[model samples]
Target: GTPDAEEPTVTAWGLEGSSLRPGQPSPALEDWEEASEWTSWFNVDHPGGDGDFESLAAIRFYYGPARVCPRPLALEARTTDWALPSDVGERVHLNPTRVFWCLNREQPRGRSCSNYHVRFRCPLEATWGSWGPWGPCSGSCGPGRRLRRRRCPSPAGDACPGRPSEAQKCVRPRCPGCGPNTCGCPDHILLGSVVTPSGHPLPGARVSLRDWPGTVATSDAHGTFRMPGVCASSRANVSAQMDGFSAGMAQAQANSSMSAVATVVLNKLEKPYLVKHPESRVREAGQNVTFCCKASGTPMPKKYSWFHNGTLLDRRTHRYGAHLELHGLRPDQAGTYHCKAWNDAGAVRSGTARLTVLAPGQPACDPRPQEHLIKLPDDCGQPGRGPTYLDVGLCPDTLCPSPAGSSPRCGDAGSRCCSVSRLESRKVHCSGYTLPVKIVAECGCQKCLPLRGLIRGRVVAADSSEPLRFARILLGREPIGFTSYQGDFTLEVAPSTQRLVMTFVDPSGQFVDTVRVLPFDPRGAGVYHEVKAMRKKAPIILDARQSNTISLGEMGEEAPLAAGIIPPGAFRSADGQPYTGAVEAQV
Candidate 1:
């Protein structure tokens, strides 16, 4: 019979190309114990309803290795109305709970399908209403409880299928100094302080208990006033008033014998003064940062503002709830920051809090799990090995201007040179970059000069072939020392074989001559070279390509100077007589 005309017999079908074909019923359908074997690709067929009903029209099945294939299962009727006969096949009530295959398939072996398409109509699902507001906390402190509830829509029989409400424990943060069992102490002292908005003490200010009238007390020079034997098992309020200042009141609950320090700040018609200021912070580039400012002034300072790098912050960009919160901080957000508390009297600025943001690859510090010292990585840079210092700068290849552009040179292009003065095995503390990395014994920039090698040699005269003693030896125009009696000297030179200029100065600090020496071999820890000195003459220049040949007379002109000539006063004798041309002058 057509599905639209009468109750057509319902049968299990094998899935094919876009159609369902009659197939043998599951072999385990009669024997319930074997049902597990067919549960993968087989589901019991049920009778159809007469009128239109709600059901899943199509379902996609995924199976095989890595869920490769996707097959869609769809339901179709013989007629357009999709009407089913009232007298369909006998229906079984074995699954009274109406459990159907909802993508729950067991993997089968030996060419058997691991997943099968499912297309059928059952009944409309029951929908639940919106959840209610959470209930109040069960306790004031410690672990508390709260709950929210929801219900199924009307017309749903009996009760909802799942839980009607959800419950969870609410945690209450413990107040500082309010230990377990101490918060309820009945015996407590009533003490407080009177201060200006700036937190400065106001001595001789009158303070009186609010709950118990006439219980007056006068503040000491320290601004502290105490009232002993006062009952504060629950709460108490105290007021302070002084001349030329507005009155102020404070409230507190006595939790301990050491009553919480209640501060009553009296307002004055003057500029605001900060009582609390934000602190310097070092945090990740993308993180939330907050700053707090507390101040007091006349009219209670109604307006609050924040500034970054001396520029006022837009109110819409940052959140203010008793403190300033910068959401999702970036590198640009790092700078010196402060807050302002203002009113009709005047505005007061708080102490600046510096925020540092480190670029990638820079040394970073991560908090220690259970310790006060921060843990750093191994590559954060090393500590000082000795008192020696070196400067490093990034540069182009053309830096230092060598005759032959062959060696690497550091110039003042893009580098931050910082001195590492801390002793060996000590931590490296940088002011702007406070984030601690691995504390190494040797500290320096990422790229630095290699360890220097000692260059030992003797300087001798070229013509006489004799050792030149008491002569000054220089490395690259810098005088290292004067030659000893043996004419032997040792100098430290940085690694790398490069052209270097060494100048020799006579003992009289005159007659200086410069010579170009061949590059030293850096393969060894120390190098030995014998320098041949020549008499003072025209300057000598060396070409790196022909370094072996020293071309003299490159320096053109040498002007004459009357140096070493005694002045007129020194020529006169002690008698103040300019005696000359006579016999001898100390011969």
Candidate 2:
């Protein structure tokens, strides 16, 4: 048999190995989903039939219009044995439009093209993911902005149609105005905090100026306060008082921002406590990751430090703070991480979290496929051996890896599947002959496409049973196909389509136009229907001076329900012109 013809060379996909960039991935991949779409794996061609040519034009010839997207973003190809083209080294041609590999076309004499399948990735649309948690404030004081972001629709992590992040003004209810003369506090504004004797946050406490009795500010839930408009002698003598404890006083060190630690501890001493801790993660090399932790205390623990595997992580390099962010992670970066919070009262360390990093070419999934048994033809089995069954072997339906790697997007990471990475051809003994069958030799991970559903039938006239040759066929208002000379037609039904509505028009005008609603399987099964059309009535001469009746048309043996009748002197021209020499009527 001849080889499968190649697709247009506008974009040739090189054999993917270590550089198989992906467009979509699995659940453990990204936190957000993509707006892009994918077609299910399709195996329209078999090795036994013309050596398995999975060309785009050939596929479109078999499956009709709209089965494939007009413009695809990416293409994936793999053999039935779940082997990638990169892993197998097949002389295959791949693009967004087609995936072609002919049996032994350019390989050794014994080599052949495996049964293959393919899928396409469509262009990104306007889909979006859920909004993420809000981030830390941009400023360390009041009226600063905090931001939260949402995920856009592309597997390639492309920017969305508009701004991906949303911002809102946020005022710190806790620890307001970190430094004096900052956060719009120019007049030596005093900032202080009130905490319980045991280091717990004192929600509602009052702090007032020593000289101005009415000039007071309440401590917020985070046990912090900020007050302005009081500039006397380079200091602010403020007193803190909570309902359960006695009054405590502290003088603000307004002249020095570094020494401006104005906190009124009810019992004089407090210990730091953990509020948030870092989380463990697994990532691939050359990717970015972040770890975060938080703490609270009497003096509001202002110092945060991070450690990796007992070694202190650099503050300037990793940006270690309440949040520690790492970029372009390498395999050497994998280790246990912890954070420490410190204040004058005491110091406390957070629980440790682990980080796992993988190399780019490493397989995250097992390369072996599971066992799958298939039954052969009835006559192929022995009389007492019951129905013949063979272990064809199959990979699980779950997501797997591919040489063309999966995108680390929201849907599925490594969008490849566990499939036949290896297979063998065999001949089984029948009663009088042998039947050739392909059995799974081995299975691994390969990308696959979904199948396209089909609808087929023939069109003919109701009276003479003649084929409705070359009639135009339309799905809705869009013309999709035409009947063959034998009146045979085929239609491909997309998975997203809910119903099939088609209109058939005869070019000869001898038959009336026909419209029908068809039923089909959404999961890529085939359906058939026979359409019957009615012939138009022939013209006949009529008398305008006497009563006359005319019959319209009929279907099968049913009575003709359409007709017209006229009495004498009823004939008249549409305009003021006289009637024609002969009155001709057709219904």
Please provide TM-scores, in order, for all candidate models, with all chains considered together. Answer: 0.21, 0.30
lDDT agreement of model 2 with the native: 0.66
The Cα local distance difference test for each model comes to 0.49, 0.66
Question: lDDT per residue, candidate 1, 193-234, as tens digits?
Answer: 788766777888888755333436888877888765444543
- Candidate 1 root-mean-square deviation in Å: 32.1
Top model number, TM-score: 2
lDDT for 334 (candidate 2): 85
- Reference-based lDDT, residue 118, model 2: 77
Give the lDDT of residue 456 in candidate 2: 94
Which segments of candidate 2 are over 4 A away from where they belong?
A: 1-371, 376-388, 396-418, 424-445, 519-529, 540-586
Which runs of model 1 end up more than 4 angstroms from their true locations? 1-270, 298-302, 364-440, 443-587
Model 1, C-alpha of 330: deviation from truth (Å): 1.5
